[model samples]
Target: MNFGDRVKEVHREILSTPHGDLPQEFVTEAVWRGEAAYFLGWAIQLFDKPHPSTFTDPGALTGVLQLLQPDANELVPSARLRAHPEIDDYSALCLLIRHLLQLQEMQAGGRDSLERAYQSRLAKLGLSPASNRLEPGAADAVISSTAKDSRGLYVVRSLAAEWLLGEEE
Candidate 1:
């Protein structure tokens, strides 16, 4: 079924169990759990069959990424990260997804890697980590650093700087 139908199904299931009959804490936990599950399912579907628009339009891709962020952020609490012992790999996942999309658009004999594409794009826009000059490997370094952690990935500070500088315009 489509996303709307799935959302409606979840809503029906949640409402079917009367909230008043459950403890307040239990109800809250259940709702959050259900929402997380729904978002996870949706994200899986997107990864399995990514819409064409997501690849063609930057805004659409951004929206899909944004939709997944809330669930990803809430799914694992920071305190529990120590007990469960998992690193936040969301940035790596996003980079992989973006690379997959870019690869799909490349010619069969194209030799460019995703890193190359990122570097080329940044160079074409004259964006460096410091914004003053493009050192030989600066783009690669910046993108690599950003992909290494969630904090760098979340705001995409360098990418935002490029956009604010009107490079895309």
Candidate 2:
């Protein structure tokens, strides 16, 4: 069945239920959960089918990676790419689903690892972290020693996404 079909039915059921009349956090969570689940399920079923190998080429992936800036702030809280009980914008959801597909293929093909990608980036900037976690380098100080370059938010977003994705993998 379609996402609209499933969600509309939920809306109908919720409107009829006692919780439906009460606009509360639980209701919001319920609706978001349903939507997120629906989208993820749809994405899995749709992409799991056979497709051309052109989509999995390394050069194509590199191009895609080059253009993909962290978009953690683009989607609404519920509409993020996470598979949590929340809503996400259509664009954000689509990008996430597509990225998952690409990452899976890249792994299967034995291509460059995401860790390597991050490491190479830091190397270019002459910055390397000794640990897996990114220390803000503000230990024992009120101010962060590492200066912000306006993309600090993006780094936080990327790290969060990477953490979540790593858990899944």
Candidate 3:
């Protein structure tokens, strides 16, 4: 299936279970996949900005559920999309989010892995530290944002600043 179809299918399965009673595993998976959805949502113009609160606030998560519903009429046609650039941005953001999350978990070698990924992805997009597209201490911001609230949304938000904000300009 195409990515749109897959997103719709996953949205169905995720929303099938009511919010309050969702298993922890299900919720964890949702947060991870939801990061992708946030990218798709931007590509399709369903979202103009990433809502970081979706990770911790039930009400915000409910709003995302509403927007991402399979039959939601928010998606634009694929013909209108600049697919390659969006894909590059998505990949870069994915790497950034993964690096930040690993750092938050105090994982060893996160910076080294991130540097490698930056060379491969962010460098091409002019987002490497040399280009100044990626702000300094972005990982620290995510870590601080989630210190009290260990939800994955802060990582999403940090990467959003790197990507979605650029889309606006």
Candidate 4:
């Protein structure tokens, strides 16, 4: 099946499940595939548009990205999305979405606000963002580190920022 069909099937399954009882494994799989499809769709849409001077509203983009961010472990592979490149691209897109969202939040209300928004967004996705944090000392270290460790996330974020700022040629 194509991406849209797969997403539809997964959405149907998720909707059919009883509230507060969705299987974690199923949710993870669904989220992985769904995020891939969502970003792929956005990529296509952005491609079709004529190059604009700048993104009309970065906040809107941040909101969409926040909503699309998946709440699953990156190591977990989705059965439906078996291609390595596809998975990598999807994960990178997710990371960029997160990075941009954090940036926007930080600009608005400093580090504390960013942390709160990040936790709140994850909670809305039914994921525990707190669990991902390291110990207080380690957390500070990680937070202070540059974003260069993940090549995929960095590359995606760079390209996205360029596009958002209308620097794309």
Candidate 5:
């Protein structure tokens, strides 16, 4: 399969499972809660999938976009996405990766621009970090799982960021 086709293939696989296939149970639970549907759609975007979704869900798109951030540099493509955009909407991936990076920033330190964007989206979702309902110390229960999975979430999100945000202008 081609790069885009590979991405779409994974997207279908990930979306097939209602609970997702994350490592930890909590992380899987969180993904099932919303992140899976959300992030899967994000992956589809990078694949250039047409008509991702129009559901009234909030975090759905953000999670996907967060994963889709094409977060790799010039060297490699993020696992979530096959190849970084060479043609259209470079900034689109950047914008998405920035959010995932914010999750890492929150995990590593505290607040920053990424956090601001995450907060904005969280606000739209009617969720809050203050809630502290999920695991991994952040409202985003998936973030910790992403960090936990070296070849899984962490690698994928990093790739998305590097591929998207770290790409040269």
Candidate 6:
């Protein structure tokens, strides 16, 4: 299915059930859809930044979905997109996703372990916690992250990256 059709279906599924009523697996898929939507929205300047969490900020996502012509296969027009993806933003988001994937690997880990692992990784790179620079492409970082999560958001972001970068080339 094309991006527009796929996202519209996901959006419909998301709205079909109320939050608390949806099954956990269903909710998880919806969260992934939200993440994908957020990425595309940010890419098109629909928002200034990706939503901080997978679950919050539905309004922004809803606005993005509403902009699509249902079942159109095509992405938002080029005129709506930024001249290009900001390398810093792309790298930072990818780094965060990579960190989350690593933390997710640890057995029965929680938020605390995530923070510790993040700091340790930062130290290893000689980067302070406040550092904005990130080393990019830790080898199939997108596939690795999406594979671990079983959610489609990372894949969507990767597709967005390819779509945008493909245009550049």
Q: lDDT by residue for model 1 over 1-169, one digit each (tens)?
A: 1233344554445444544475564554444343333323333343222221111222333344333334434333321211111111222233333444456568866746656776665456544232232235433444445433233222232233334334442
Residue-level lDDT tens digits of model 4 in 1-169: 2323344665656645653476886865444333333343344342222111122232333244332234222212332323433333333334334555457446654867667765554444333433343234442343344344332333343344334323342
What is the C-alpha lDDT profile of model 5 across 3-32, one tens digit per residue? 333556445444344443444534543433
- Per-residue alpha-carbon lDDT of model 3 for 56-128, expressed as tens digits? 3444544753554553444333324435555444444545755656655665657687667556655555545
Sort every candidate by TM-score, greatest first: 3, 6, 4, 5, 1, 2
lDDT of 1 at 57: 29
Clashing pairs in 3: none
> lDDT of all the models against the reference?
0.37, 0.33, 0.52, 0.39, 0.38, 0.53
- Each prediction's TM-score versus the true structure: 0.22, 0.21, 0.51, 0.25, 0.23, 0.47
Instruction: Give the per-residue lDDT of model 2 (tens digit) for 111-134.
Output: 457546545643442233222232
Best by TM-score: 3
| Candidate 6, pairs of clashing residues | none
Local lDDT at 85 for model 3: 53
Order by lDDT, highest first = 6, 3, 4, 5, 1, 2
Kindly give the number of clashing pairs for every candidate. Answer: 0, 5, 0, 0, 17, 0
RMSD of 4: 16.9
- Over 29-88, each residue of candidate 6 has an lDDT whose tens digit, in order, gives 776666666766776776765523233366666555554546333444442765432633
Q: Cα lDDT of model 5 overall?
A: 0.38
Q: Which residue pairs clash in candidate 4?
A: none
- Candidate 2 C-alpha error for residue 127, in Å: 24
